[model samples]
Target: MKFRKVTETDVAKIVEMIADDELGKTRENYQIPLPTEYLIAFENIQADPNQELIILENENFEIIGTLQLSFIQYLTYRGRIRAQIEAVRIRKDKRGFGIGKKMFEWAINRAIERNAHLLQLTTDKKRQKAIKFYEDLGFKATYEGMKMHF
Candidate 1:
């Protein structure tokens, strides 16, 4: 498999991945939803300098997985750069092949290339497998993040 930045042509595959109803518990609450406006927003975000959206491609150049890492520069940490990782998904049939791990490594490397000092991600507490996977990759659970959804 090869890794590359996302393009407009890969949106359908990404939507498929995002809309999967089953795989892990985190997906259970997500309802696997992604609206068209979200796609437009992602397109705009991808064009910005602070975001990195990457996909893994097979021999036929079909996207098999995707991950997005966004850099956050904060004044609280003395201007240290941070990266928030999101949308990490691999095709259901493509699991156990190390694709997710590779995608994650690519994102971490991208974060370093962009001068990020820390990387963070959030998963549902019920997703034990996913949480273990992230922990195996050296990610720790430290903070409780609250969200206000509209």
Candidate 2:
């Protein structure tokens, strides 16, 4: 598998990957008339130096996974920068093949390359399997994650 920055052409596949899952079914819209918001968001992400949207592909160049990483420079932790991983999704048919592990390992190496002192991500409370997967990857559930939707 190979990982690379996402291109405009990959947005449709990424959207499909996100919408294929149970949780995503309720959250994503990928009907005949695609949403402009997705394109707008993709453009914005591409323009931001601190934001990275990555796509993972196999030998046949099929998009199989994707994730976004953002680097934030904060005053906390002695002003160290932190890398936050988000929007991680692997093709439903491609799970349990060590692809996720390889993805995380790549993300960690990327965080280190960016001089980020900490790497972090938050998964939904309903995703127990994902939580365990993260734990197996050495992530600690040290804080409560709370959010409010507008």
Candidate 3:
């Protein structure tokens, strides 16, 4: 297994993985959604110096998991930077096999490479296992995340 930046060729596999996750449910609410295009946009964001997204692939070069790392700069913290981790997904069949742990480690390393002070992510309350996984990885349940779906 290896971790790398996404390429255009990885769009199809990336879409498959995303469409099978909770994100797909969000997309379903859209009148017309093109997952392939979304993947392309992710690549674009990663290419930008201000953004980053890392993908996990197996020996066959299939994108089995993904995570987004956004570098944030804050004034209150004296210009300290942090990496906000998001959209961490592992293929349903590939869950419970240490894939999440490995992917998270990569994200942490990526944050360190970029000189980020902290790594953070949020999960829905219903995803109990996911919350536990993050805690096991040393992520604390710091603040409650609230969102208003429009």
Candidate achieving the largest lDDT: 2
What's the best-to-worst order under TM-score?
A: 2, 1, 3
Top model by TM-score, which number? 2
Give the winner by lDDT: 1 or 3: 1
**Model 1: worst 10 consecutive residues (lDDT sum):** 24-33
Compared with the true structure, what per-residue lDDT tens digits does model 1 show for residues 58-122?
Answer: 89887889888888889967899999998899988888998888888888888888888889998
- Write the residue-wise lDDT of candidate 2 on 1-150 in tens digits: 899999988999999988997889999998655699999999999999999999999999999999999999999999999999998999989998999999999999999999999899999898999999999999999999899999
Model 1 gets an lDDT of 0.81
Question: Which residue segments of model 1 deviate by more than 4 Å?
Answer: 23-35
lDDT of each: 0.81, 0.95, 0.79
Question: Which residue pairs does candidate 3 place in steric collision?
Answer: none
TM-score for each model? 0.87, 0.97, 0.85
- Candidate 2 vs candidate 3: which has greater TM-score? 2
Residue-level error in angstroms, candidate 2, position 10: 0.2
Off by over 4 Å in 2: none
> Residues 1-150, candidate 3, lDDT per residue (tens digit)?
998877766655666666676657667322224445575586678678867767888899777898778898887577888899987889888988999999988889988998888998878788898888889999998788899989
| Candidate 1 collision pairs | none
Error of 2 at 60 (Å): 0.2
Error of 1 at 14 (Å): 0.2
